[model samples]
Target chain A: MNEREFLKQYDKTAFDQPIFSVDNVVFTVANGGLEVLLVQRAEHPFKGHWGLPGGFVDLQKDLTLDDTALRKIREKAGVEPDYIEQLETLGSSQRDPRDWSITTVFTALISKQRCVPTDENVSSANWFPVTTLSELQLAFDHLEIIERALKRLKNRATYSLVPCALLGETFTLAELQHVHELILGKKLEAKAFRRRVENSEQFEETGGMTSGRGRPAAYYRLRPGAMGFEFVRSV
Target chain B: MNEREFLKQYDKTAFDQPIFSVDNVVFTVANGGLEVLLVQRAEHPFKGHWGLPGGFVDLQKDLTLDDTALRKIREKAGVEPDYIEQLETLGSSQRDPRDWSITTVFTALISKQRCVPTDENVSSANWFPVTTLSELQLAFDHLEIIERALKRLKNRATYSLVPCALLGETFTLAELQHVHELILGKKLEAKAFRRRVENSEQFEETGGMTSGRGRPAAYYRLRPGAMGFEFVRSV
Candidate 1:
């Protein structure tokens, strides 16, 4: 049928409604492994269970999904993060109990920062290592969300120095390598890693030095506007 | 606030409702360039305008986002695609004039196959080259979605053998290179590209030969269940 024929049969309101929400997986490096920030639910649906910090998006106020993510982080964690990326969208009719909904998952990075729940629906906010996340049951499909975020982080770490977001403003080369090792789950050759970093041209010297014992390593920071490195793998 | 205290102040119904939808960017390689499948709208908002082939999710019956995508393609187009990946979600309050809405975008690749609109809301379904997408005024924010999908395809081609989806079931190494060149928008080195393809270990010989005038190239196909390649760049 032509455009006119199709127009006559089209119904404008033939669509179902669904609630849209945002969930955040805030990751930070602490102790010796990667940790994710989670909040305890206080509602009847798996009440008192652990889950990623999240909330329903206010369509009247939030302009974009990114805005909703930032707002939810602030409302739940009480701090701004350094890096945030849209990880994936988990949508299904049975994922949420109250209504059919879709949740756009986001992955954020912070440097061992504290997150305190500003909302009453959440009982507690704390960081848990990725290795131990499987032991505890998370509300909703949060466990799957965290797993996807970790996989994305690992893939991104190959071409980009994104794991540096887990460290302070300035860090030593050894500290940087450790972050990479923790995220990649493998020990990298120190010499090859240094060479790849220098070739990427994404970092600059901070004109400072580490004051700890042993040989003082130079403090280097991500360049002003570096997006990612050129190397795929170094070790 | 404690979890108990937070739960007291939380209102489950305190959220603004928005319309949720899905849009697909179906791409294929034909006539020496990349093409995208589009449909002419027959509704009032953008009657007679071109847009990505898509529709709203049915919360009443649809189970998952992936299912919705598959159904939309089967309903809008007549055939199923070989590859589909979540591109990105385009969300905003002002994007839709009739109502506030958010649409999750998906990118799909198929061999040069035909697609016909099964719904009347779409007058015509046709494929347009990516290079000439700007010449046509697409409805809503589809232009942005197509641009993003093209960029994603280029990046994904660097790491994965996704471009092979655009070719037929059996193809020579040279035909495969041509597909990569079209997607990457650049010519690649033959010797290095071959070495990289061999190292990826994602292809196997079919023991068939191309029946052409000149030297017959050996027909090769993607190894059964080959996900992605390891080569980043060889040119």
Candidate 2:
């Protein structure tokens, strides 16, 4: 094309831009503990290493980048984030060794019981306690992802009914405390925590007793319209 | 650079990864209300338009993506995110008209008193009331940026004390509610919200009271050691 035509024919809409990708940190609560789900990679580069289950975006695929990531989770892990949100973007000049890859890290809170190991790209899958994950060699920048995910979850526990996301329909408050303590990495003031949680109006007593033989704790779960963001301005 | 050399010596960081950029949403509580800080772009594409304060990342120039972003916030808008964090990344096939730019959005809450607009690239900087922002025209995906920033801040409100980032070093609980009402888009039930907030121990009730108020609201801010990302867990 001539310079005149080229100057006037710049199609911004059709301009060639770089590609985008997504990664996920899928977490679940199992055996009254907090754990992160990881898979053993079968491909080269980081082959034979365990990592967070995620893959590239098929440029030819027919979906948005965010949707593609969630679909990949379902495609590989057989479990989707019951609740998913974008965490951060990891886009250093050389974050990946292949092509220019821009990754939007998404955090997925899913049910631990429903997960099954079933992906061709993966050798095996399992959940590891957050505290005990250092022993497992992780691929890419996954260790950093776990640390950030844990931080976000821990911060939310004190003020929100966050642990409920990892639980089934019915659970005792004691079970909730166990999850919180694990995430918080310490025991909490039982009476103080109980009073505060019971006062939020975010949870209900469920009017049912615990299943165990010990202290019969009150069963509770999230109340309707209660599982979302609420910005509390500090003065 | 020969094919044999390329095969024999693998450069681990050789792929084309989309560069990550961060757009900051810095808000402050001023003039009896909540307001967002914005900058006028001086460069091409969105030149002279009001946009969220942000810029491209010189990844090698900074250690971490968030660090690069925080630097850009001051460079572009002359402001800092007191409540700085990685909110989300916007990376569609064509979000940027220039190149493949996958931007991670960061929202910082600070007392407006701490910041002032002073940069040549930023033509005019000002805080627009959060309530009336919808009526103004914001460049790029800024409208969407504000929406997401508000949502995340609001979502974290009911459960976290991070919002204290928006307040002055010393202020009353009623002052906090004003910031909340501005962001939440509705007046909150004072009695319940107050009770819930006080229980979190996010703030200390300094022996002070509102000068001109009914029943002298109690003063509070993010509790010193009581606040941290250590407990924040992600998916």
Candidate 3:
């Protein structure tokens, strides 16, 4: 059948409408472990409980899901994430209370920078250790979202240089390894880790030194074009 | 503000309602390259042009988006892909002709299998080599979706066992390497490839062999519970 003939029989208004929202699972390495940014909801529908920083995607101002996430972060926390990627999409019949909605989940990795007090919608914003996340009462399916992001983060740290977002612009090799260990929950042999990093072609020595109360170490930064490099690794 | 005060000021009805849809990129390796399953649209919007097999979410019957993708694939093609993963979510407000819709894209990898004749709603179903996909006029933003999925497949073949889905249930090491090369578009050193595969711990030797004209080669299958293994390789 020709496309024009098919179009003549098609009806566009017959499809059901569903709402779409964006949620961000922002992670940062702080306090010697992996931490997640959570906000205390001040409104109904699981009010007062903790939830990931997110809101309804504003199509009026946002161009993509990535823009929605960045806008939400900027509006609620007054800061931007270091790295953001689409994690997953959750669309169930009853996942939302307000409507039959589809939420596109995004994972935003950032350094240990606190969310500035910018909005009254959230009573409090804090970073909690992911290991003890079970103790807190979270709103909606946020706990599941965080778990999925955590799994992705752990797996991605081995291949992509995304985890570098959890470190400052310039960091020592030890600091980089520490961020990796916190996410993967395992210590890496220093020699092997260094060798892998050197072979990855993702990092470049910055010719700077770490400022700390110890023997100063050389610093390095991720090469500009290597952010999307997929280095194979046996994580 | 306390939680109660915040709830009093919050308004849920102010959020804009957006429609949701699911799109599937069913991929297979055929004709010596990667191929994507495309169905001719028998309805309007892009009547006659080819598009990814998908439909509006059937929240009335399906429980989740994953279920929606599976149900659509079953209804349209009469076959289930071997490995399916959430790829990305596209929500650009005016992406749809009927309404503001957000479509979650899924990538379903399968071995070279033919799509059975099924739904009459689709004018036709065919597989096209991804390399020449640009020549075909695709409906909606399907061309962009396929490109995203193709990039993901190429990168994923280096780390995860997903590329194995493009091969038969059991395959020889040489065949497995061929699948990887086809997807990655590069040749791998045989010795290095074997060493990396053995180190992955994701595959095990099966007590069977492939009967070919040259010589019988031992068969290997993905180790139990290793389909989700994240093997590291420097792709």
Candidate 4:
């Protein structure tokens, strides 16, 4: 038979399918620490437990997996992320209680000031410190998902300007370093960090200054059209 | 209802599901170039067309996505990979003709010497040079998937011992550099490359030497229990 004829006679329901879904681990630097946005599940199969913002893919609405992930982030967290990328895909028969399931995970970075968590389609949405995540009772395998996202974020911060997404529109180098330190959970050598950032040429002086305890620090912002710049060396 | 009771009554078939499958972009350094493994489809819709080795996920036989990918690699390529990692997940309505489909892509690296391609469930299995991938009429968005995997492999080669997987059990530093150059498509500075490799401390002298052109090059192999080592700087 020809290709078209074969497709026409294909039976898609001949085999069992897994539950496919998208989940977003939205992150921000707030309250002197890294925080993740999570929603309290209002439905069964881990009701009332905090989980990453996610749901089943809507075949009619989502044209791609990214659309499903962004839709979940906006609907559950009430915030549009500044930076997002696919972290990893996790699947198994034991992860979810419903059935064999697979979830494409996305890691998103946004400023906490821009997020206004809404209680729509969920019990509540809130930001919790990543350091204390082990103390909370989370839904499904979300704790492991968050930990994986955190590891990726920390690794990227070592050699890329990924943590800058958590800062405001304009900020000093000191502020940028602080955000990186929060994500990495360690302090970087100041001179080496500045050298790496300056060498990347991804940032520019905004001709402004911040009046802090030390000498007024010059403000800077990402160079126009610059995004996801990586350094040749880690700081 | 409680968690167990809720799962018992959950209707898994309520929503239309997408066809889920796993594909492997197996890479090897052979014939002095980077090559990818391709299998000719034996069944319709795109029968007779060359595509990445893949098939629909068998829910009963496969316990995880990685298992599905490995099973496809073994069945179609007839080789076990030395290194494997998830490249990305691609899904859409237009990619598949039968129904909405999603595929998790994996990037695998193995030496050409170890692979013995067999046509068990496929019409034929062979290796094609990556440089000529554009000329071939591939099936089911596989060309794009392969390109994405190639980009990732190239990126990882710059700062990690990733391309070493394409080498045999033991090789010389010169042989390792040749593999990296093939993947990166550029000649690396000898001193810088040696510095990065030595600094990572992932390889150890195998006490063997290759008697080639000028001098006898010492052979080396990965340190015991050493894997996925990343450098702090790009070579």
Best by lDDT: 4
| Model 1 regions more than 4 Å off | A1-14, A113-123, A227-235, B1-14, B114-123, B232-235
Q: Return the TM-score for each candidate structure.
A: 0.89, 0.65, 0.82, 0.93
State in Å the error of residue B33, model 4: 1.8
Residue B188's lDDT within candidate 4 is 91
Question: What is candidate 1's lDDT per residue for B22-132, written digit by digit as tens?
Answer: 999999888889999898876756777899988888777689998888888777667788889898887887787656678999999988854445565434788898888
Put down candidate 3 lDDT per residue, A38-101, tens digits, no spaces.
8887766778789988887775777666788898877666678888888888888777665566
Q: After superposition on all CA atoms, how large is the RMSD of candidate 4?
A: 2.3
**For residues B123-187, what per-residue lDDT tens digits would candidate 4 score against the true structure?**
48889999999988899899989988989998999878989999999998889999999999999
lDDT tens per residue, model 2, B1-235? 5434544575433434343456888878778777887877665556667788776555346545677778877775576767687787776556656444467788888777777667775557767888787887777788888988888888766556667677778777777777767666678777876776666556787777776745766676566776542212210
Candidate 2 residue-wise lDDT at A47? 74
Model 3 has a DockQ score of 0.40
Candidate 4, residues A1-235, lDDT tens digits: the string is: 8988888888877778888888999998888889998888889988989999988777899888888888988887676898999999999988998888999999999988877666555348888999899999999999999999999998898878878999988989999999988877788889988888899999999999987687998999999777888887777
Lowest summed lDDT over 10 consecutive residues: which window, candidate 3 chain B? Answer: B114-123
Distance from true position, residue A97, model 2, in Å? 7.9
Best-matching candidate per TM-score: 4
| lDDT for each residue of candidate 3 in B140-209, tens digit (9 for 90 to 100) | 8899999989899888878777888888778899989998999899998999888888989889889998
Residue-level lDDT of model 2, residues A1-235, one tens digit each, is 5434553664433422233467778878877677887878766556778888777655455235576678878876776666777777776545555433456777777767667656654347767888788898888778987898788877777566666677776777777777777777889777777766666667776898876677777788777777763323100
TM-score of chain B of 2: 0.80
RMSD of each: 4.7, 7.6, 4.6, 2.3
Given the true complex, what DockQ would model 1 score? Answer: 0.39
